[model samples]
Target: MGPLPLNYRRPEYVSEEDSRQEENSADFYDKVDASLQSGPSGTSTGIPDALTFDKIINGGTCPPCTVRDFMNYLIYIEHAAENLQFHLWYRDYVKRFDAAPASEIALSPEWTQTMEEDTIAKIQKDAADKAKKVSPIAREIFRGTDFEKAPEIRVESRDPFSTPPRSSSGDSVSLSGSQATTYVSQEGDAFFAAGVKQPFTIQPFRSEINRVIATYIVDDSPRQLNLSAREQKAVVRALSYTTHPSALRTLSQNIENTLRRQAHPNFIRWTICNGNPARVTFARGLGVGTILVAMTGSIILTLSKAGRGWRALFAILWVIGIATLITAAKGMCVVLHGLHHRHVRPWELFIDDNATGIEQLCEGKRSFDSFDSCNSYEDEPWVVRYQRRFYVRKVFDRQVWIQEPVLRQIQDTIFLQSMLLALLGGGTLTAIFLAVPAGNFF
Candidate 1:
C-alpha cells in the first residue's frame, strides 16, 4: 500500500509503448492505491449481498480467481505471497498432525504426565504389597487410623487419554479454528490421546517444525512473516512441548484474517478491472460484422421506399446491432453471457518457434499415419506450462473457464445494459420513423 517497490514492472504487456507508459503512469498507481483501501467489500461484485469473501476463496469451480491466479497476484501485485503459502502449508500440516501415530502423539506433555502418573501408581502398589506382608495386628491398627489414607495426586483440566471433542455427527472437531473440520482417522484418534494443551515434539515433526521456524518464524529468514514478538514467542514455546498443529493456530488465524480483510476484497476489485475479460478477438469481430449488416439493412430500406411495416422492421436490426456494438465495446459477448467458458486465444495454442523446438520436431514427421511416432516429445498440461511462462495470465485466456459468481454478476449487468440500450434506441427510432410517411423524402 505504501509506494509500490521501485523495481515493480508490469507483468502483462499488450504493446511495448503501452507497457512503457503504464510503468511510469500515475493513474495506475492511483488505481492500486484505491484498491488497497478498505471500504465496502464489493467492487463489481455485490459483496455480502450476492457474494462474500468466503465464496471468493472457496467457491467450487467458479471462484472469481483461481488459487493460482490469486497466488500470482499476491506474488507480483500485492508482494505478500508468503501469507498464502504459510496458510496453505499450515492447513496440510494440521491434517498430517491429526493423522500422526500413537507413539508420536504420546510425546505430548499431557501424555508424559499420564505415563508419570502410571509409574507413581505402580510404585504405590508395590509399597501396598509390602504392607500386606506386615503383621495382621499392625495392618489392622493402621487400617482404622487417618494415617492409612493415601494422598491423592490431583491433575487438573487436562487428561491425555480423554476422547476429543466431537460434533453432532460425532466427527472430531478441528482444534485449530472455530470452524469444525473432520480429521479423525478410522483408528482410535491420536489427537484425543495426545491432548491439545501442550506442544508436540516428536522426531520427524520436530525437524519439520524446526524447518518452519527457520523459514517463516525467524526475523532474518527469507519470507519471514510480520508476526509480533509475543506471538512468535508463544508459538515457539507451544511447539517446544509437542509437534501438535494447534501450536501455530494463532499465527495461521492472524494471517488468514489479514488476507480476508485486506488482500481478498482488493483482489476481487483487481479482477473487475483486469481479469474479467468477457470476450476475445473473435467475438469482437462478430460484433463489427453485425454492425455492418445493420447499416446495410438501413440503406436498403431507405432506397426501396418500403412500406411502414417494412420500415418498422428496421427496429430488429437496430436492437441486434446496438446490443452487439455495446458488447464489443465492453469486451463482452452476449452468447457467452453467464457462461464460465471462453475461446482459447490463437496465440495461446501456438508454440513459439523461437522459444521451443517445434520446427525441429516437425522436420521428418509425416501426417496421419506416423503421428503416434512423435511421442518422443513429452507433454505437460498447458496450464502448468503456461504458468511457467513470463506472462501473468488472466482468467479469460483461451481454453480457460471461470465460474466466478462476481464475474457472472458483472456479465449479467453488462447484458442487461445492452438490452436496455437496444430497447431505448430501437424504440425511439421506430417511433420517429412511424411519424413520417415511408415513401416521402421529408
Candidate 2:
C-alpha cells in the first residue's frame, strides 16, 4: 500500500477536456473581433482605414502610425451633429409666418383726414410759437435777405428798333432804388429792410439763397405765380441789359445785324453774349495782350540804353513791366511774385455793364411780380429755378463769373505798373553793358 498506485492517487490528466476548452476560447475571441469590424450591417465594416478619418476631417489622409487621426474623427462627428441640429431649427423657423401688415396698408379716407388735421394743427401751433419767439429785430433781419428787397435800379429791354424813352437826365430811364445793403454781426449778417414786399432785399448769403429762391418760385399763393413764356423772356432780356450794360450795345448790334439778315426773332435773342464762348475768348485776349506789352517794352528799353549799369536796370524794369501788364490784364499781378518772394500788386478794374447783364440773363427764371411762368420740363421746383440756374451757370460758366472780380482787383493796383516800369529801366542799363565791347571784359 506504500506507493500503491502512484498513478491512481495522482489526479487524472484530462487532455480531451483541456483541448475542447482551449478551442472554445479561441472561437469567442474571433467572434468579438468580427463584431467590432462589422457595424450593424451584416457586411464587413472595414472600420474606415484609420487614415480615412483624417482625410475627411482635415482634407487629407492621416499619415500611417499617427494616433491623432482617431481623435480628429471624433471631433468631426461632434461638429456634424451640431450642424444637423441647426439645420432642423432653421427649417422650422422659415416654414412659419407671424407678422402684422404695415401701417401704410391702413391708409383710408378717415385715417388720412385725421392725419391731415393733426399735421395742420401741429404746424400752426409751431408757427405761432416761432413767431412769438422771434424778435422784431430778427424779423427785420430775415426780411432783408431777398436780393430784390429793393426795387430795380435800372431796367432795359431787348428791342433795338425802338429807342428807350429818355429820363429827366436824357439817359435811358433808370429805376430808382438803392443797392442791397449788407449787415455784419457775430451771429450772422442779414440784408433787408423791415416790412419790405416779397422778394425783399438782403445781402445774398450762401446758405439762404437757394431756399429763398425756391420758396418764391414754388408758392402759388395767388400773390406769386409764374409769368407767361413771352413775358418771362421779355423780363429776362430786360434784366440782362440792366445787369450787363457793356454787353448791351454788343447785344443790340447783334440783334440789328440778325434782323437785317432776316433771322428769326428767337434766334436774334438767343445770340445774347454768345454764352460761355465769348468770355473764354476775352480771357485769352487779355493774357496775350499782357505778354506782348511786356516783350515790346523790354525790347525798346534794351535798345535805348548803353553800359552795364543801364542794362541791368533795364532788365529789372522789363521783368517788372511784364508782371504789371499781366496783373493789369488779368488781375493776377503776382504771377512771378511767388518765385521771387515779391508781393502781388492789387488788381485793376474792368468796367463792363455787359458782365452784369449776362449774369442776370443766364440766371434762369425768377418769380417776378408773383406771376412768372415756370419751365415745367425743368426738374427744379419753381422757387428754386433761378437759384439752381445761378449755381449751374457759375460752376460751368466760371470764366464769365470770374471776370468782374479779376477786373476790379487789377484796377486798384496802379503802383504795380510803376514798379514794372522801374524794372524795365534797370534792364535798359544791362543791355548797354552787353552791347559795349569794352564793358564786357569787367
Candidate 3:
C-alpha cells in the first residue's frame, strides 16, 4: 500500500466531548491564574502564568498558590462568622424585648440583667488577670513598700467654704499614699464625707463629680440610685459656693485676656477660641527668616573665596538652606490647641446646680421663692459666670495640641524620606569636596 496514501487514512479527529473538555480545562487554568494574581498579602509570583490549562484541568497541583488561596478564603469566612454572630445576638436581644408587655417592658432593664451579671463577672476576672500581669512592672517602678505604711486622710468639712481635712480627729490633713479622706459641708448644716483607701487617692473632688455627671448622662436608671446619692451630696456641696455666673464670667474673661497677650498671637487665639488657624504665619515667617540668613551668610563666604570651586560650595549651601526651610514649613506642630473649654462647665461642676439652674430657668422662679427648693447663693448668675471663666482659664487655655497615633505614623514616613535626602546631599557634598583641588579654595 506504499505507506498508505497520505490522505487515505482517516485523520485522528477530536470528538465534541474532547473539545468541550479542552475548553473546560482552559477555563479552570484561567480562574487559577486570576486567583493567584489577586492573592492575599498583595504581591504575586508569575510562576503560575506558565501553567498549561490541560494540566490544571487534569488535576495537576499548584501547592503554594492553593495554600495561599485557602488561607485567604479562611480569613473571609472568619470575618463573616463574626458579623453573623453580632447580628444574631442583636436580633435576639431585640426580639426578646419586643415581645414583652408594655408594663413589663418599662420595668425591664435596657440591658439583659442575667447577661449583664455574667458579662460583668467576666470583665472583672479579665481585669484582675490583666492587673496581675502588670503588677510586677508597677512594683518595680514604685520601688518601695512605703505605700502600705502611709497614713490615710479622712476629709471633713465644717462650712460650705471650708476645705475638708483628711482626718476629722486630726488638726492637719495627711495627703500621703492611696488612703486619703476629705470632708465637705453639705446643704443645711449637713456634712459630706469620703474615705479613699490604697491604690486609690482623692483626686480633686471635681473629677468625682464629673464621673457622676457622665454616669447620669449615659444611664439614668434608678439602679444607680446609690451612686447618685453619694455623688449628689458631694456635687451639691462643692457647687454651693462656686459656679456663679459672675464668677464664671470673671474667670473666663481673665483667661481670654491673658491668652491674647502672649507673644505668639495665633497660638494665643487658639488657646482662647480653641480653634486651629489654617495657616501659622509666625512660624512660617521664622522659617523663611532662618533660610534667608543662612543663604546670605553662604553668599558672603562664597565672595571671600578666590576660585570657581566656591560656586559649587555656595550652590550646596543654598540647597541645604532651602531644603531645611521647606522641611520646617511642612512639619506640623504636634501640640496644637482646639476649640474646647479647659474647665468644667458651670453646669458640669455640680449636677445639683445644673438641675436647679435648668428648673429655675425654665420656670422663671428663684430658688428663694420656695423653701422646699434646694436653693443656694452659689446658683446666682454672677457665680455661674465666674465658674465658667475659671474653667476656661484653668482647664481649656492650658491645653496644647498633641499628635494622634495616625498623624505620628505619617510624620515617621516623612522623617524617613528626609533622612534619605540628607544622606544623599551629604554624600554629594563630600564627593565635591574630595574632587576639588585645595588651591581652588582661597
Candidate 4:
C-alpha cells in the first residue's frame, strides 16, 4: 500500500524499460572509456593514427588490413614534418632574430668539453634504444629518421658554369657561356642566351658568385633543405677568397642575400621527381577530380550571385580550383609533407617478409603502445609476406588502390620554367573572374 511495507518483499520481473535503461548506461560508460583512451587533440593519437605510415603501407583496419605501429614510413614522416616546420621556424623566429637591431640569434647553451661529450653520448644511447625497441624484425622496416647530421652542400668542379680557362700568357680568361642556349638553375629560373649575352662586365659580379654557389649543392635534396653551419661558413669564406680584398665587403653582402634565396621553401612539388613511372602516370589520372570540383564551384557561383554570399563563394571555389590543379598536376601532398613522410614506396621494400618476420611482428603487437598492458585492444601488425601476396593475388584492382600511387607524387619542386606560362595564364583568368558578375564569371 505504501510502496510495499518493510515486511513484504516485492517479486522480481523482466521489463522492456529495464533493458533500455541498462543499454543506455552501457553506452555512456563506453563513451567515457573512449575519451579516457583518446590522446590529446581528441584524436586516437594527437596525430590521427590512420595518417601514420603503417596504414599507408598495410591498409585499413578491416579484416583484410594489416597494421604496423612502428613503420619506417612513420619515421620518415616525422622528420619531413620537422624539416618543413624548420623553414617556417627560420622565417618567423630566426628571421626576426636576424632583423633585430640588438638581438642576434642565440646559440645553444655553452657546454664544457666533458658536457659536450656527455650530450653526444646520450644522443647515441637514445638512438640505440630506439633501434633495440623495434626488435631485429622491425629493423628492416623501421629505418631511423634521426639523422646524425643533415647533408651538406659540396662544391663540385665547374658547377653552374663552363670551365674557366687561362690564356696562353697565363692571365685568367673571362668566365664564359653561350647566351643563346637556355640554362635551368636550381631555383628553376631559365635564362635565354639573348638575356645574358651582353653580360661579361665585372658589374653584378656579386650575383655571379652567388649563382655559382647555387650550382654547388646536390640536386637530390630539396631546396627547402638547410645547409649545415660549417658548410654555410665555408660557402661565405670561399666566396670571400674569390673576390678581391677591396671587394670583400660586397662579397659578404652577396653571400648573405644568396642564403635567403637558397633556403626559400618550395611552393610546389612534382611526383615525377621522386616517384616511379607507375606513380607519375597515376597522378595524371586525378585531373578529372579537379575538373569536377571546378565545375561544381562554377555552378554554385553562378546560382548564388544574388548577394555577398556569392562573392565569398566565388573566392572559395577559385582558391579550391587553384589548389586542385596544382595538386593534380604537381603531385604535392601537404599532409605527407607536414608529417615528413614521402609516400614513395612500400614497407616491404625495407623489411623481410618471411614467416619469421610475421612471427616477430605479431609477438607483442598491441592497439595502443603506451596504454595498459592488460588492455584487450587488438592491433596485430600486418604480416608483410601475407599482405603483399594478397595485393598481388587481387592484381591490386581495389578501389583504394588508386590513392596509393597518387600519395607518392606529392612533395615535388614544380619546374618554374615550365609552370611560369601556366601561372600567368591562371592569374589573368582569376583577375577576369573576380571582376565579372558571378553568373558570367566563367
Candidate 3, residues 302-362: lDDT per residue as tens digits? 4455554454554454444444444344432212312211222232234444457677455
Best-to-worst order by lDDT is 1, 4, 3, 2
Candidate 3 Cα errors over 4 Å, as ranges: 1-279, 306-324, 328-331, 334-403, 422-442
Q: What is the C-alpha lDDT of each candidate?
A: 0.50, 0.29, 0.31, 0.31
TM-score of each: 0.41, 0.17, 0.22, 0.23
Error of 4 at 265 (Å): 22
Specify the poorest-scoring 10-residue window by lDDT in model 4.
260-269
Q: Between the candidate structures 1 and 4, which one is better when assessed by lDDT? A: 1
On lDDT, the candidate that comes out on top is 1
Superior candidate under TM-score, 3 versus 4? 4
In every candidate, how many clashes are there? 9, 72, 41, 11
Best candidate (score: TM-score): 1
Candidate 2 regions off by >4 Å? 1-294, 314-317, 320-442
Compute the lDDT of residue 425 as modeled in candidate 1. Answer: 85
Error of 1 at 125 (Å): 52
Better of 2 and 3 by lDDT: 3
Better of 2 and 3 by TM-score: 3
Instruction: Mark the 10 consecutive residues where model 3 has the least summed lDDT.
Output: 217-226
RMSD of each: 22.3, 43.7, 33.0, 28.9
**Cα shift from native, residue 193, model 4 (Å):** 52
